[model samples]
Target: MVYKMSVYYRATMCITLMLLLLNLCEKGYGVNLRDMQVPCEEVYMVKEGETLNSISEKCGDPFIIEENPHINDPDDVFPGLIIKITPFRLYSYKF
Candidate 1:
């Protein structure tokens, strides 16, 4: 009977320690929505009467600025174009 009681007490202590460690680790690794929340980059759809200057004002500046050599070429951007105002970074979680 004494041996059985000792074994049961040890098992109980081990289970309790395991539970405590698991709880602490979960809190350390869990991601809170507010902590990870990031603002979405604003994108503009080119309109018929929109100009680059106006778009720049509305969307701030682009991360990259490349000037097209041919302003009148077929690939030249016009009003009502979709432009990305911000770049995104990939994030990894390490626990």
Candidate 2:
């Protein structure tokens, strides 16, 4: 009876530990995993002499205008505007 109780206690503790680990694994960097399902985004900082036109041209995609809604005006972008950039991705997977 004592051996059976010990085995049962160990099993319960192991299951609890596994569940705790799984819960911790779900939260990553405070970013919602669902938001990233729409697009794979990159962070880019505005630099001197860099305009929205220039950045889009460099990226070879005018879609930056659509992706970056914070930029009210492409021409009106100023230095230090943190814009969201989506690069062409070959594949994506969940962590």
Candidate 3:
């Protein structure tokens, strides 16, 4: 009778430990993930010699204008030329 009781108690302890571990696994590290979805917006032209970096600092993320690499030579932008700052992909996931 004593041996049966001991075996039963050990089984109960193992089951309890398994349940606690399962509970901890279910409540994983709580981190809220977010998708950075910013929309495109327009920005007015600045005076000559202004740079994209400077404009980004003043305007903010998802910067006011999307510069076209094809036409917008970083070294040669003219004043009064409007530019479209379109939404561009910023991140990717691989698995």
Best by TM-score: 2
lDDT for 14 in candidate 2 is 100
What TM-score number comes out for model 3?
0.33
Count of clashing residue pairs in every prediction: 3, 0, 3
Tens digit of per-residue lDDT, candidate 3, span 46-83 = 56777666655544544443345445455566777666
After superposition, the stretches of candidate 1 with alpha carbons farther than 4 Å from their true spots are 29-95
What would the TM-score be for candidate 2 when compared with the true structure? Answer: 0.46
The CA lDDT at 62 in model 2 is 68
| Consecutive 10-residue window with the lowest summed lDDT within model 1 | 62-71
Query: Candidate 3 at residue 80, lDDT?
Result: 74
After superposition, candidate 3 runs with Cα above 4 Å error: 1-41, 61-72, 86-95
What is candidate 2's local distance difference test score? 0.72
RMSD of candidate 3 to true structure, Å: 11.5
lDDT of 3: 0.57
TM-scores of the candidates are 0.31, 0.46, 0.33
Give candidate 3's error at residue 48 in angstroms. 3.7
lDDT of 2 at 6: 100
